[model samples]
Target: MTALDPFTDALDCPLYVVTATAAGERAGCLVGFASQCSIRPARFIVWLSKANRTYRVAARADRLAVHLLGHDQDHLARLFGGATGDMTDKFTRTAWHPGPGGVPVLDEAPVWVVGRVQSRFDGGDHCGFLLAPEAAQHPGGDGVRLMFLKDGPDISPGHPAD
Candidate 1:
Protein backbone atom coordinates (compact mmCIF):
# COMPACT_ATOMS: atom_id res chain seq x y z
CA MET A 1 0.00 0.00 0.00
CA THR A 2 1.07 3.57 -0.55
CA ALA A 3 2.32 5.75 2.35
CA LEU A 4 -0.83 7.91 2.20
CA ASP A 5 -3.10 4.86 2.37
CA PRO A 6 -2.07 3.92 5.86
CA PHE A 7 -2.18 7.48 7.07
CA THR A 8 -5.64 8.02 5.70
CA ASP A 9 -6.89 4.73 7.09
CA ALA A 10 -5.66 5.60 10.56
CA LEU A 11 -7.42 8.96 10.64
CA ASP A 12 -10.51 9.21 12.78
CA CYS A 13 -12.94 11.71 11.24
CA PRO A 14 -16.44 12.67 12.30
CA LEU A 15 -19.40 10.94 10.61
CA TYR A 16 -22.55 12.76 9.42
CA VAL A 17 -26.09 11.99 8.52
CA VAL A 18 -26.82 13.91 5.34
CA THR A 19 -30.38 14.33 4.20
CA ALA A 20 -31.98 15.89 1.12
CA THR A 21 -35.37 16.24 -0.49
CA ALA A 22 -36.56 16.72 -4.05
CA ALA A 23 -39.65 15.97 -6.10
CA GLY A 24 -41.49 15.31 -2.88
CA GLU A 25 -39.08 12.50 -2.04
CA ARG A 26 -36.72 12.57 0.91
CA ALA A 27 -33.58 10.52 1.46
CA GLY A 28 -30.69 10.37 3.88
CA CYS A 29 -27.48 8.41 4.39
CA LEU A 30 -24.41 8.19 6.56
CA VAL A 31 -21.50 10.28 5.34
CA GLY A 32 -17.81 10.21 6.24
CA PHE A 33 -16.55 12.60 3.55
CA ALA A 34 -17.58 16.15 4.36
CA SER A 35 -15.96 19.34 5.56
CA GLN A 36 -16.00 23.09 5.65
CA CYS A 37 -14.44 23.97 2.32
CA SER A 38 -14.74 27.74 2.31
CA ILE A 39 -14.76 30.45 4.96
CA ARG A 40 -15.11 33.73 3.06
CA PRO A 41 -18.57 32.74 1.90
CA ALA A 42 -18.95 30.04 4.52
CA ARG A 43 -19.39 26.90 2.43
CA PHE A 44 -19.53 23.26 3.45
CA ILE A 45 -18.97 20.40 1.07
CA VAL A 46 -20.70 17.06 1.47
CA TRP A 47 -19.62 14.17 -0.72
CA LEU A 48 -22.35 11.65 -1.36
CA SER A 49 -21.79 8.28 -2.98
CA LYS A 50 -23.35 8.15 -6.44
CA ALA A 51 -24.77 4.72 -5.72
CA ASN A 52 -26.82 5.97 -2.77
CA ARG A 53 -30.40 7.17 -2.84
CA THR A 54 -29.44 10.37 -1.03
CA TYR A 55 -27.19 11.37 -3.90
CA ARG A 56 -30.05 11.10 -6.36
CA VAL A 57 -32.32 13.19 -4.22
CA ALA A 58 -29.58 15.72 -3.58
CA ALA A 59 -28.97 16.16 -7.27
CA ARG A 60 -32.32 17.89 -7.61
CA ALA A 61 -32.61 19.26 -4.14
CA ASP A 62 -32.22 22.95 -3.53
CA ARG A 63 -30.92 22.40 0.00
CA LEU A 64 -29.50 19.74 2.26
CA ALA A 65 -29.25 19.08 5.98
CA VAL A 66 -25.98 17.89 7.50
CA HIS A 67 -26.29 16.40 10.96
CA LEU A 68 -23.69 15.65 13.60
CA LEU A 69 -24.28 12.29 15.28
CA GLY A 70 -23.23 11.92 18.89
CA HIS A 71 -20.63 9.34 19.86
CA ASP A 72 -23.27 7.46 21.81
CA GLN A 73 -25.69 7.62 18.90
CA ASP A 74 -24.30 4.68 16.96
CA HIS A 75 -27.82 3.37 16.60
CA LEU A 76 -28.67 6.47 14.57
CA ALA A 77 -25.55 5.93 12.54
CA ARG A 78 -26.51 2.32 11.87
CA LEU A 79 -30.00 3.29 10.79
CA PHE A 80 -28.67 5.62 8.12
CA GLY A 81 -25.49 3.73 7.25
CA GLY A 82 -26.54 0.11 7.46
CA ALA A 83 -29.81 0.10 5.51
CA THR A 84 -30.63 1.09 1.96
CA GLY A 85 -33.53 3.47 1.31
CA ASP A 86 -34.39 1.74 -1.95
CA MET A 87 -36.28 -0.92 0.00
CA THR A 88 -36.64 0.86 3.33
CA ASP A 89 -38.34 4.04 4.50
CA LYS A 90 -35.59 5.27 6.75
CA PHE A 91 -37.20 8.60 7.66
CA THR A 92 -40.34 6.88 8.91
CA ARG A 93 -38.22 4.93 11.35
CA THR A 94 -36.35 7.97 12.62
CA ALA A 95 -37.31 11.24 14.29
CA TRP A 96 -36.98 14.13 11.86
CA HIS A 97 -38.74 17.27 10.75
CA PRO A 98 -38.73 19.23 7.53
CA GLY A 99 -36.21 22.02 7.57
CA PRO A 100 -35.43 24.79 5.10
CA GLY A 101 -36.25 23.86 1.50
CA GLY A 102 -38.02 20.74 2.75
CA VAL A 103 -34.85 18.98 3.83
CA PRO A 104 -35.33 16.41 6.54
CA VAL A 105 -33.64 17.46 9.76
CA LEU A 106 -32.76 14.83 12.33
CA ASP A 107 -34.41 15.86 15.56
CA GLU A 108 -31.92 13.91 17.63
CA ALA A 109 -28.87 15.53 16.12
CA PRO A 110 -27.45 17.88 18.75
CA VAL A 111 -25.93 20.12 16.14
CA TRP A 112 -27.14 20.55 12.57
CA VAL A 113 -27.03 22.87 9.61
CA VAL A 114 -29.38 23.51 6.72
CA GLY A 115 -27.76 24.87 3.63
CA ARG A 116 -28.66 25.74 0.09
CA VAL A 117 -26.83 23.94 -2.68
CA GLN A 118 -24.38 26.33 -4.26
CA SER A 119 -22.64 23.96 -6.64
CA ARG A 120 -21.85 20.33 -7.35
CA PHE A 121 -18.61 18.71 -8.45
CA ASP A 122 -17.87 15.37 -10.08
CA GLY A 123 -15.53 13.35 -7.88
CA GLY A 124 -15.14 9.86 -9.26
CA ASP A 125 -17.54 7.49 -7.45
CA HIS A 126 -18.85 10.30 -5.27
CA CYS A 127 -20.10 13.81 -5.99
CA GLY A 128 -19.51 16.91 -3.87
CA PHE A 129 -22.27 19.35 -3.08
CA LEU A 130 -21.17 22.75 -1.91
CA LEU A 131 -23.60 24.24 0.55
CA ALA A 132 -24.28 27.80 1.71
CA PRO A 133 -25.59 27.91 5.22
CA GLU A 134 -29.21 28.95 5.62
CA ALA A 135 -29.92 27.87 9.17
CA ALA A 136 -28.15 26.26 12.11
CA GLN A 137 -29.27 24.64 15.34
CA HIS A 138 -27.10 24.05 18.37
CA PRO A 139 -28.99 22.70 21.34
CA GLY A 140 -27.17 23.88 24.43
CA GLY A 141 -26.04 20.81 26.31
CA ASP A 142 -22.97 18.75 26.93
CA GLY A 143 -20.74 18.79 23.90
CA VAL A 144 -21.67 15.48 22.27
CA ARG A 145 -18.56 13.77 21.01
CA LEU A 146 -18.83 13.12 17.31
CA MET A 147 -19.24 9.61 15.97
CA PHE A 148 -16.21 8.71 13.87
CA LEU A 149 -15.77 6.41 10.90
CA LYS A 150 -13.65 4.07 13.01
CA ASP A 151 -16.53 3.83 15.44
CA GLY A 152 -18.73 2.20 12.80
CA PRO A 153 -16.37 -0.30 11.22
CA ASP A 154 -19.13 -2.93 11.15
CA ILE A 155 -21.55 -0.59 9.38
CA SER A 156 -21.93 -1.88 5.85
CA PRO A 157 -22.72 1.08 3.60
CA GLY A 158 -26.35 1.48 2.74
CA HIS A 159 -25.27 1.83 -0.86
CA PRO A 160 -22.19 0.10 -2.18
CA ALA A 161 -19.60 2.42 -3.67
CA ASP A 162 -19.00 2.17 -7.38
Candidate 2:
Protein backbone atom coordinates (compact mmCIF):
# COMPACT_ATOMS: atom_id res chain seq x y z
CA MET A 1 0.00 0.00 0.00
CA THR A 2 1.74 3.10 -1.31
CA ALA A 3 0.74 6.59 -2.39
CA LEU A 4 0.83 5.66 -6.12
CA ASP A 5 -1.09 2.37 -5.83
CA PRO A 6 -4.27 4.13 -4.77
CA PHE A 7 -4.22 6.47 -7.72
CA THR A 8 -3.24 3.77 -10.20
CA ASP A 9 -5.78 1.26 -9.00
CA ALA A 10 -8.64 3.73 -9.06
CA LEU A 11 -8.11 4.76 -12.68
CA ASP A 12 -10.46 3.07 -15.13
CA CYS A 13 -10.07 5.00 -18.32
CA PRO A 14 -10.57 4.32 -22.02
CA LEU A 15 -8.35 1.67 -23.55
CA TYR A 16 -6.36 1.98 -26.78
CA VAL A 17 -4.62 -0.35 -29.17
CA VAL A 18 -1.25 0.96 -30.25
CA THR A 19 0.44 -0.51 -33.33
CA ALA A 20 3.87 -0.03 -34.82
CA THR A 21 6.22 -1.54 -37.38
CA ALA A 22 9.95 -1.33 -37.97
CA ALA A 23 12.31 -3.17 -40.30
CA GLY A 24 9.47 -5.42 -41.39
CA GLU A 25 8.61 -6.31 -37.81
CA ARG A 26 5.09 -5.48 -36.67
CA ALA A 27 3.81 -5.28 -33.14
CA GLY A 28 0.91 -3.99 -31.12
CA CYS A 29 -0.49 -4.03 -27.60
CA LEU A 30 -3.36 -2.78 -25.51
CA VAL A 31 -2.52 0.51 -23.82
CA GLY A 32 -4.16 2.18 -20.86
CA PHE A 33 -1.72 5.07 -20.62
CA ALA A 34 -2.28 7.34 -23.58
CA SER A 35 -3.65 10.83 -23.90
CA GLN A 36 -3.53 14.20 -25.60
CA CYS A 37 -0.50 15.94 -24.14
CA SER A 38 -0.43 19.19 -26.11
CA ILE A 39 -2.86 21.74 -27.49
CA ARG A 40 -1.07 24.25 -29.71
CA PRO A 41 1.31 21.80 -31.31
CA ALA A 42 -1.21 18.95 -31.14
CA ARG A 43 0.64 16.06 -29.58
CA PHE A 44 -0.35 12.75 -27.96
CA ILE A 45 1.64 10.45 -25.74
CA VAL A 46 1.42 6.65 -25.60
CA TRP A 47 3.25 4.73 -22.93
CA LEU A 48 4.42 1.17 -23.71
CA SER A 49 5.62 -1.37 -21.22
CA LYS A 50 9.29 -2.19 -21.62
CA ALA A 51 8.63 -5.91 -21.16
CA ASN A 52 6.22 -6.07 -24.09
CA ARG A 53 7.14 -6.92 -27.66
CA THR A 54 5.41 -3.82 -29.00
CA TYR A 55 7.89 -1.65 -27.18
CA ARG A 56 10.79 -3.43 -28.84
CA VAL A 57 9.47 -2.71 -32.32
CA ALA A 58 8.36 0.78 -31.36
CA ALA A 59 11.90 1.53 -30.31
CA ARG A 60 13.00 1.55 -33.93
CA ALA A 61 9.73 2.68 -35.43
CA ASP A 62 9.32 6.23 -36.61
CA ARG A 63 5.53 6.24 -36.33
CA LEU A 64 2.63 4.53 -34.59
CA ALA A 65 -1.12 4.17 -34.95
CA VAL A 66 -3.34 4.70 -31.95
CA HIS A 67 -6.84 3.25 -32.02
CA LEU A 68 -9.88 3.80 -29.88
CA LEU A 69 -11.83 0.60 -29.40
CA GLY A 70 -15.55 0.68 -29.07
CA HIS A 71 -17.20 -0.87 -26.05
CA ASP A 72 -18.51 -3.74 -28.18
CA GLN A 73 -14.99 -4.51 -29.29
CA ASP A 74 -14.16 -6.45 -26.16
CA HIS A 75 -12.72 -9.35 -28.16
CA LEU A 76 -10.34 -7.04 -29.98
CA ALA A 77 -9.22 -5.50 -26.75
CA ARG A 78 -8.65 -8.89 -25.20
CA LEU A 79 -6.74 -10.13 -28.19
CA PHE A 80 -4.35 -7.23 -28.07
CA GLY A 81 -4.22 -6.92 -24.34
CA GLY A 82 -4.27 -10.53 -23.32
CA ALA A 83 -1.98 -11.97 -25.95
CA THR A 84 1.73 -11.46 -26.26
CA GLY A 85 3.35 -10.70 -29.61
CA ASP A 86 6.24 -12.99 -28.72
CA MET A 87 3.84 -15.94 -29.04
CA THR A 88 0.91 -14.59 -31.00
CA ASP A 89 0.89 -12.88 -34.37
CA LYS A 90 -1.84 -10.43 -33.52
CA PHE A 91 -1.65 -8.66 -36.87
CA THR A 92 -2.39 -11.81 -38.82
CA ARG A 93 -5.28 -12.67 -36.55
CA THR A 94 -6.83 -9.23 -36.94
CA ALA A 95 -7.84 -7.01 -39.83
CA TRP A 96 -5.56 -4.07 -40.54
CA HIS A 97 -3.71 -2.22 -43.25
CA PRO A 98 -0.36 -0.63 -43.48
CA GLY A 99 -0.66 2.96 -42.38
CA PRO A 100 1.74 5.91 -42.45
CA GLY A 101 5.36 4.85 -41.79
CA GLY A 102 4.32 1.20 -42.07
CA VAL A 103 2.31 1.26 -38.88
CA PRO A 104 -0.56 -1.19 -38.76
CA VAL A 105 -4.01 0.36 -38.35
CA LEU A 106 -6.74 -1.68 -36.74
CA ASP A 107 -9.86 -1.64 -38.86
CA GLU A 108 -12.21 -2.27 -35.96
CA ALA A 109 -11.41 0.93 -34.10
CA PRO A 110 -14.01 3.64 -34.41
CA VAL A 111 -11.38 6.36 -34.26
CA TRP A 112 -7.69 6.20 -35.00
CA VAL A 113 -4.66 8.36 -35.65
CA VAL A 114 -1.33 7.82 -37.33
CA GLY A 115 1.43 9.92 -35.90
CA ARG A 116 5.13 10.35 -36.12
CA VAL A 117 7.25 9.75 -33.06
CA GLN A 118 8.59 13.12 -32.09
CA SER A 119 10.20 12.22 -28.80
CA ARG A 120 10.53 9.51 -26.15
CA PHE A 121 10.90 9.52 -22.40
CA ASP A 122 11.98 6.89 -19.91
CA GLY A 123 9.20 6.52 -17.38
CA GLY A 124 10.30 3.70 -15.11
CA ASP A 125 9.05 0.30 -16.44
CA HIS A 126 7.29 2.00 -19.34
CA CYS A 127 8.46 4.50 -21.95
CA GLY A 128 6.42 7.40 -23.24
CA PHE A 129 6.27 8.03 -26.96
CA LEU A 130 5.24 11.53 -27.94
CA LEU A 131 3.44 11.66 -31.27
CA ALA A 132 2.76 14.39 -33.77
CA PRO A 133 -0.36 13.37 -35.64
CA GLU A 134 -0.11 13.20 -39.39
CA ALA A 135 -3.38 11.58 -40.35
CA ALA A 136 -6.62 10.40 -38.76
CA GLN A 137 -9.91 8.70 -39.46
CA HIS A 138 -12.95 9.35 -37.34
CA PRO A 139 -15.85 7.14 -38.23
CA GLY A 140 -19.24 8.65 -37.60
CA GLY A 141 -20.19 7.69 -34.09
CA ASP A 142 -23.38 5.67 -33.83
CA GLY A 143 -23.61 6.16 -30.09
CA VAL A 144 -20.94 3.55 -29.55
CA ARG A 145 -18.90 4.08 -26.41
CA LEU A 146 -15.19 3.68 -26.01
CA MET A 147 -13.95 0.60 -24.17
CA PHE A 148 -12.75 1.09 -20.60
CA LEU A 149 -10.58 -1.00 -18.32
CA LYS A 150 -13.53 -2.21 -16.27
CA ASP A 151 -15.09 -3.58 -19.46
CA GLY A 152 -12.34 -6.14 -19.87
CA PRO A 153 -12.48 -7.93 -16.56
CA ASP A 154 -12.05 -11.33 -18.20
CA ILE A 155 -8.91 -10.33 -20.05
CA SER A 156 -5.75 -11.82 -18.63
CA PRO A 157 -2.64 -9.93 -19.64
CA GLY A 158 -0.38 -11.83 -22.01
CA HIS A 159 2.64 -10.08 -20.65
CA PRO A 160 2.70 -10.57 -16.93
CA ALA A 161 4.79 -8.68 -14.42
CA ASP A 162 8.31 -9.85 -13.85
Candidate 3:
Protein backbone atom coordinates (compact mmCIF):
# COMPACT_ATOMS: atom_id res chain seq x y z
CA MET A 1 0.00 0.00 0.00
CA THR A 2 1.18 3.52 -0.78
CA ALA A 3 0.42 6.74 1.00
CA LEU A 4 -1.93 9.08 -0.92
CA ASP A 5 0.41 12.05 -0.71
CA PRO A 6 2.96 10.33 -2.91
CA PHE A 7 0.47 10.37 -5.77
CA THR A 8 -1.32 13.61 -4.89
CA ASP A 9 1.95 15.48 -4.32
CA ALA A 10 2.71 15.58 -8.01
CA LEU A 11 -0.78 16.64 -9.04
CA ASP A 12 -1.27 20.30 -9.92
CA CYS A 13 -4.74 21.63 -9.33
CA PRO A 14 -6.39 25.03 -9.58
CA LEU A 15 -7.41 27.03 -6.55
CA TYR A 16 -10.89 28.45 -6.15
CA VAL A 17 -12.59 30.93 -3.90
CA VAL A 18 -15.84 29.40 -2.74
CA THR A 19 -18.43 31.74 -1.29
CA ALA A 20 -21.69 31.06 0.48
CA THR A 21 -24.36 33.02 2.32
CA ALA A 22 -26.86 32.07 4.98
CA ALA A 23 -28.66 33.67 7.92
CA GLY A 24 -27.63 37.18 6.87
CA GLU A 25 -23.97 36.27 6.88
CA ARG A 26 -21.55 35.81 3.98
CA ALA A 27 -18.42 33.71 4.01
CA GLY A 28 -15.77 32.56 1.56
CA CYS A 29 -12.44 30.73 1.50
CA LEU A 30 -9.83 29.48 -0.88
CA VAL A 31 -10.27 25.83 -1.77
CA GLY A 32 -8.06 23.39 -3.64
CA PHE A 33 -10.10 20.22 -3.37
CA ALA A 34 -12.84 20.43 -5.95
CA SER A 35 -13.64 18.91 -9.32
CA GLN A 36 -16.30 18.25 -11.87
CA CYS A 37 -17.51 14.79 -11.12
CA SER A 38 -20.22 14.35 -13.74
CA ILE A 39 -20.79 15.40 -17.29
CA ARG A 40 -24.18 14.14 -18.42
CA PRO A 41 -25.88 16.06 -15.66
CA ALA A 42 -23.00 18.42 -14.99
CA ARG A 43 -22.26 18.03 -11.34
CA PHE A 44 -19.38 19.48 -9.32
CA ILE A 45 -18.01 19.05 -5.86
CA VAL A 46 -15.99 21.28 -3.54
CA TRP A 47 -14.57 20.02 -0.29
CA LEU A 48 -14.54 22.52 2.55
CA SER A 49 -12.40 22.12 5.62
CA LYS A 50 -14.40 21.28 8.70
CA ALA A 51 -12.43 23.84 10.73
CA ASN A 52 -13.25 26.82 8.49
CA ARG A 53 -15.98 29.36 8.91
CA THR A 54 -17.03 28.84 5.31
CA TYR A 55 -18.12 25.36 6.16
CA ARG A 56 -20.20 26.63 9.03
CA VAL A 57 -22.06 29.09 6.82
CA ALA A 58 -22.33 26.64 3.97
CA ALA A 59 -23.96 24.20 6.27
CA ARG A 60 -27.09 26.29 5.95
CA ALA A 61 -26.59 27.83 2.56
CA ASP A 62 -28.41 26.56 -0.49
CA ARG A 63 -26.17 28.09 -3.09
CA LEU A 64 -22.45 28.76 -3.53
CA ALA A 65 -20.31 30.60 -6.01
CA VAL A 66 -16.97 29.31 -7.21
CA HIS A 67 -14.54 31.86 -8.60
CA LEU A 68 -11.64 31.13 -10.89
CA LEU A 69 -8.42 32.90 -10.01
CA GLY A 70 -6.26 34.31 -12.76
CA HIS A 71 -2.50 34.33 -12.84
CA ASP A 72 -2.49 37.98 -11.84
CA GLN A 73 -5.09 37.44 -9.13
CA ASP A 74 -2.74 36.09 -6.49
CA HIS A 75 -3.68 39.00 -4.26
CA LEU A 76 -7.28 37.84 -4.13
CA ALA A 77 -5.99 34.34 -3.50
CA ARG A 78 -3.97 35.59 -0.55
CA LEU A 79 -6.84 37.65 0.74
CA PHE A 80 -9.15 34.64 0.78
CA GLY A 81 -6.53 32.01 1.56
CA GLY A 82 -4.42 33.63 4.30
CA ALA A 83 -6.35 36.23 6.25
CA THR A 84 -8.79 34.87 8.76
CA GLY A 85 -12.33 36.18 8.30
CA ASP A 86 -12.82 36.09 12.06
CA MET A 87 -11.12 39.49 12.30
CA THR A 88 -11.57 41.13 8.91
CA ASP A 89 -14.61 41.65 6.72
CA LYS A 90 -13.09 40.49 3.46
CA PHE A 91 -15.99 41.88 1.50
CA THR A 92 -15.15 45.46 2.39
CA ARG A 93 -11.76 45.15 0.73
CA THR A 94 -12.88 43.37 -2.41
CA ALA A 95 -15.33 44.09 -5.22
CA TRP A 96 -18.34 41.78 -5.26
CA HIS A 97 -22.11 41.71 -5.40
CA PRO A 98 -24.78 39.45 -4.05
CA GLY A 99 -25.56 36.77 -6.55
CA PRO A 100 -28.17 34.01 -6.70
CA GLY A 101 -29.50 33.18 -3.25
CA GLY A 102 -27.35 36.02 -1.90
CA VAL A 103 -24.12 34.23 -2.66
CA PRO A 104 -21.18 36.63 -2.91
CA VAL A 105 -19.72 36.78 -6.39
CA LEU A 106 -16.28 38.25 -6.87
CA ASP A 107 -16.33 40.89 -9.59
CA GLU A 108 -12.69 40.50 -10.45
CA ALA A 109 -12.86 36.85 -11.27
CA PRO A 110 -12.81 36.33 -15.02
CA VAL A 111 -14.68 33.07 -14.77
CA TRP A 112 -17.17 31.88 -12.21
CA VAL A 113 -19.96 29.45 -11.51
CA VAL A 114 -22.95 29.51 -9.23
CA GLY A 115 -24.28 26.17 -8.11
CA ARG A 116 -26.99 24.86 -5.91
CA VAL A 117 -25.81 22.31 -3.39
CA GLN A 118 -27.36 18.99 -4.29
CA SER A 119 -25.84 16.95 -1.51
CA ARG A 120 -23.31 16.90 1.29
CA PHE A 121 -20.95 14.17 2.38
CA ASP A 122 -18.70 13.87 5.38
CA GLY A 123 -15.19 13.33 4.09
CA GLY A 124 -13.46 13.06 7.43
CA ASP A 125 -11.53 16.33 8.03
CA HIS A 126 -13.59 17.92 5.27
CA CYS A 127 -17.19 18.06 4.07
CA GLY A 128 -17.90 17.64 0.42
CA PHE A 129 -20.58 19.89 -0.99
CA LEU A 130 -21.86 18.45 -4.20
CA LEU A 131 -23.00 21.24 -6.49
CA ALA A 132 -25.39 21.21 -9.37
CA PRO A 133 -24.43 23.89 -11.86
CA GLU A 134 -27.03 26.55 -12.36
CA ALA A 135 -25.09 29.39 -13.91
CA ALA A 136 -21.60 30.01 -15.24
CA GLN A 137 -19.47 32.50 -17.14
CA HIS A 138 -16.33 32.16 -19.22
CA PRO A 139 -15.18 35.66 -20.00
CA GLY A 140 -11.46 35.33 -20.49
CA GLY A 141 -8.75 33.51 -22.35
CA ASP A 142 -6.54 30.79 -20.98
CA GLY A 143 -4.71 32.81 -18.39
CA VAL A 144 -3.03 30.47 -15.99
CA ARG A 145 -4.42 30.60 -12.50
CA LEU A 146 -2.66 29.59 -9.31
CA MET A 147 -1.91 25.87 -9.16
CA PHE A 148 -0.90 23.92 -6.10
CA LEU A 149 2.70 22.62 -6.24
CA LYS A 150 3.10 24.20 -9.66
CA ASP A 151 3.45 27.77 -8.47
CA GLY A 152 3.74 26.92 -4.77
CA PRO A 153 3.14 30.55 -3.89
CA ASP A 154 3.71 31.52 -0.30
CA ILE A 155 0.28 31.36 1.26
CA SER A 156 -0.95 30.48 4.70
CA PRO A 157 -3.02 27.31 5.04
CA GLY A 158 -6.33 29.22 5.43
CA HIS A 159 -8.53 31.18 7.78
CA PRO A 160 -12.12 30.55 8.74
CA ALA A 161 -14.87 31.70 6.37
CA ASP A 162 -18.10 32.09 8.33
Clashing pairs in 3: 53-161, 53-162, 54-161, 54-162
List ranges where model 1 is wrong by over 4 Å. 1-3, 140-142
Arrange candidates, best TM-score first. Answer: 2, 1, 3
- RMSD (Å) of each candidate, 1 decimal: 1.5, 1.3, 2.7
**Higher-TM-score candidate among 1 and 3?**
1
User: Which 10-residue span in candidate 1 carries the lowest summed lDDT?
Assistant: 153-162
Model 2, runs deviating above 4 Å: none
Give each model a TM-score: 0.94, 0.94, 0.91
Better of 1 and 3 by lDDT: 1
Better candidate number, 2 or 3, judged by lDDT: 2
Candidate with maximal lDDT: 2
Tens digits of lDDT, candidate 3, 14-95: 8889999999988898888999999989999999998888899999999999987876787888888887677668898899
Task: Provide the overall lDDT of each model, using Cα atoms, as 2-decimal numbers.
Answer: 0.91, 0.91, 0.85
> Residue 4 in candidate 3 has what lDDT?
93
Ranking by lDDT: 2, 1, 3
Q: What global local distance difference test value does model 1 have? A: 0.91
